[model samples]
Target chain A: MTDQPWIAVDAMGGDEGLEVMLAGVARARRRFEGLHFYLVGDEARIRAGLHSHPNLSANSEIVHAPEVVGSSEKPSQAIRRSKVTSMGIAIDLVKQGRAAAMVSSGNTGALMAMAKLSLRMLPGIDRPALAAPLPTLGDNDVVMLDLGANTEVDARNLVQFAVMGAAYARVILDLDRPRVALLNIGSEDQKGTDWIREAAAELRAATHLPLDFTGFVEGDKLARGHVDVIVCDGFAGNIALKTAEGTARFVGDLLKRAFTSSVRSKLGFLISRPATQLLRDHLDPNNHNGAVFLGLKGIVMKSHGGANELGVATAIANAAKMARADLTRRIAEDLGLEHVA
Target chain B: MTDQPWIAVDAMGGDEGLEVMLAGVARARRRFEGLHFYLVGDEARIRAGLHSHPNLSANSEIVHAPEVVGSSEKPSQAIRRSKVTSMGIAIDLVKQGRAAAMVSSGNTGALMAMAKLSLRMLPGIDRPALAAPLPTLGDNDVVMLDLGANTEVDARNLVQFAVMGAAYARVILDLDRPRVALLNIGSEDQKGTDWIREAAAELRAATHLPLDFTGFVEGDKLARGHVDVIVCDGFAGNIALKTAEGTARFVGDLLKRAFTSSVRSKLGFLISRPATQLLRDHLDPNNHNGAVFLGLKGIVMKSHGGANELGVATAIANAAKMARADLTRRIAEDLGLEHVA
Candidate 1:
């Protein structure tokens, strides 16, 4: 791992086209010294955009990809046309070992489909999981996994998600060993489905793994940050993630209505604006901009499709960090798939 | 269906014991005129507590019971000793037609078990579902069902939940035909399991029901208020409810920390204390107090275990309203089980 290890970027993907993508790449390069980028998209458009940022242009090269994947495209359809798509070629760079990692703010399903096809699954891994950092009351954010990768998971899949999540937490959060828990309806011993209970049994007896397997955690304890890694099937995990987001928005709306109800409160709001600003920044989802696809052959991070330059830059920084840490290899080692490498 | 119908209360259940329970009953008696209470617990202790409120004593009668179910006790274990426990007897009062409805702040599983066993399921209903009103940005609260009554539910169970939830909304929220939606991880038709997809298809093609099936809603759109009835299996529904609760608490805690940070902010907080208080009250779980067990032969509401006097009173008020509206009978009519009744 070097400071200049190449990180692939899907220039034609994301909400704001090449403009925001290049700006984010420039911002990331400014922060991480000697950073190199492979911009995969239309070379003419990328070169035109890069002309505004001389430093980023000097350290980057463009790989032209004429086609692009639409957000509405089916995964099966996207896979057939991956060879010509910007997101597809970027993922190909990782598979070909020309780039250490690939980052996209494009069509999520398409990105997942192309990455899975090109990189393939690691040894002993039936499926890869989508993981992201969620804000918590504790000092460090907790990592939650299988957000929407695999809808239905068996006990073995849940156990694999635990291993992948723990390894990712160790690399990103810099923890030696992390406490892992299964997300269930209730914290009781017999609360959830047979698969969850079976997974709990397996994790409890898994003496070879370097994880502290706490039995079960209710959904309300998710943001309390008592555990480092929380694992669940994509269906439940995805629902939990969105429910939290909606609740945050609901609270914010209520606070605003309360603050603006009277002139006295308005004056008070101005006085306490700075304090509320701090809270606002912390609660903002943009601060947590990166969600990586774990258990792939190479690192692939998904930026928010509608993320701004700062959000995109955060994803790039996380991608660069994961590539530098050799995250995929670490996951392989944790799964006892080191021999496969 | 009179306002003075006897409503059973579990006097010995919940964290605060007999004192809070009686106080809440007293408060409800004051709020709603001609409300009679069937207190199920130890008669001596109840009489001692009732001495503090002559008004409540005049309107209440005690049903003695010596047994109590521990919160840690499993449903199977609780069912074995159902005849003696306060919660079990309270439910029995409803089944025996001695009380119009039952309200408890006790072991939820035990209460569900006892109620289901005593009352039995309504005709055309496979199993009972737990439902409660959740706050929303719209004018009225949304009704969500299967909050953990059954661990898993099939397509038919989901449809039945919709019918019951819509009926509850009609009585509680006073809507003619509420908009119902299935809670899924994604709004896309292809996104969930075969069970949910099948459920969605059935609801979509259902022309006989009074409900307007609005297809699918993601977890984040829950509080948007656009959909009136949100249906899911117990597992997913439970997660959504708890996740929303946790997120609200997390946000509130962060806001408090922000308000207390600086001298300027402290002065501003004093000026806007009323406004923030309004926000806190709105966010409090006490205001949204009662969670009803639907599909039962009779009405049974579950109050928050650690709720304060005000919280308990809210649950009691809701119980009185549901009892007067004849919620169980309305659900029976909706399920075409009125003939059986």
Candidate 2:
């Protein structure tokens, strides 16, 4: 406990190879002083990349990993090669107590499969939910979970997700009682699948929990910033998340076209550069990078594969924060209290 | 067919009630020269409302229905009172062969329940799918289906939705062979639930069908203007749709704030008014209002409950277009072909 817990980095993962990952770790080093890392990847390449990133090199140790997990590899296939692969070794660092957390911008399914097999699920969690922060108009980002993790989840799974999500919000957003809502087609009690209604009933009765259950929320109200945690089955959650991302990008594209449509518009765009830049920063996926795989024993953060240095740093910071907050322990305690109630 | 079909309008439905509905019909009358309407609502209100719109009055007749379906009413409750409800009577006009199609902005659950019971499903269709046109970067809007009609659907239901959605797209988008894709979390074949994979396999094998069965599209690609028809189960479809709507509005809200943040931004906004207007029109829900209940015996269009006069008119125009194109017959024929294949 005296020694600082190391955070593992999959230096070989993502679309950009070892250089970007190492550089990202280097960037994160500037933000979080005293943060140490177990840089897991090809030793020679990582060493070579670290030449350009002296800051990361000082705070990190190279752990050689012979193989790399391909982005297109199936979870099963990736799991088979987890022992020697960078993603697998990084996860093993977390399991072996060498690292408190791991960060990877690798094959999502592969990373998830490896992390589950290595770290395993927390005590009370039947299935792990993939939770991520979505930028909202409110003071804090809303955490949405079970995003393509469990395609078909029962009421019990949904209820557990809500508990886990609330715990996560407490750690990440620093809220005492996060307002949680079940995602539905309509806000009415009778709306959505039977499982959803049952989950709603259970959540409504869960007065002993630290979280405040805010009832149902439709897809349209997600970014309105009213609720802190939104829970749903992976199928709907994934669709909603991707749809929101696509729509934001779609409108951004249209905005670009609109600004370039005429000479007068071009002048206006030039004059409004700062204002539009703020909007851009708000909408950028990179600014809101890092999707945490909750319900796991050890912290594992997944960065957007196409993300740049700042995004990777954000993911690392997020993972480090979760680790420091003892998110796993908090969730376990909440689940224990929930079970008692 | 030669006598010219009357499109039934639920004049007392929607948030705006008789005034907006009648005004929308009057506007549609201006666009579609010979379009007749069987306005179903309170007799006195219709007659009084028609006084302002001489265009609609000359082209249409009114049917009296004293009862109005409240937006909060359950579908079962509404169905029990369908005999006296304006929405129910309008649908009955279609079933009784007095009107070619019906348009309502009333309680969607009630409207769907009434329409399904009154019109019945087309042959080879098990459950009805709600299809709506969504704005895209393409020349024509993409038609997505099963938008909260059937919460759960099998592979067979999905296959049928694709066929119905394609048929709707052909009539609405006027494409010879619309590109159809199954909505999934990933573009990969094995990314989703068993039913989704099964549906994909079925759709891939359905080469004899009119639609070009593209493999799979993620929710983010929904507005990319690549596919003409995106098909999925009602739950995911509804979530994706509302998420898109919510994201668009979220961004629009942010844009407004950005423009008004400073005097410089305000000046820029004024100069770029025309360009922003184009974007606003492109993203407006009213420009894409009508949602068709596909696979039904009669065409029933559900407009957005909060839609304005222009939105109502757009829905009416969409319903009239589908009626003229014989959308129901086309879908039935396509289903017959699919069954044979």
Best by TM-score: 2
| lDDT, candidate 2, at B61 | 88
Report the error of model 1 at residue A270, Å: 0.9
For residue B300, model 2's alpha carbon misses the true position, in angstroms, by 0.4
**lDDT by residue (tens digit), candidate 2, B149-239:** 9999999999999998898888878888899999998887788989989998998898999999998899889999999999999889899
Give per-residue CA lDDT, model 2, range A225-297, as digits (tens).
9999999998899899999999999999999999999999999998888898999999888888899888889
How would the docking of model 1 be graded?
Answer: high
Question: What C-alpha lDDT, on a 0 to 100 scale, does residue A104 get in candidate 2?
Answer: 95
In model 2 chain A, which range of ten residues has the least summed lDDT? A1-10
Residue-level error in angstroms, candidate 1, position A152: 0.8
lDDT of each: 0.90, 0.90
Which pairs, if any, clash in model 2? Answer: none
TM-score (0 to 1) of chain B, per candidate?
Answer: 0.97, 0.98
CA RMSD of each candidate after superposition: 2.1, 1.2
True contacts kept of 1: 0.79
| Candidate 1 accuracy as lDDT | 0.90
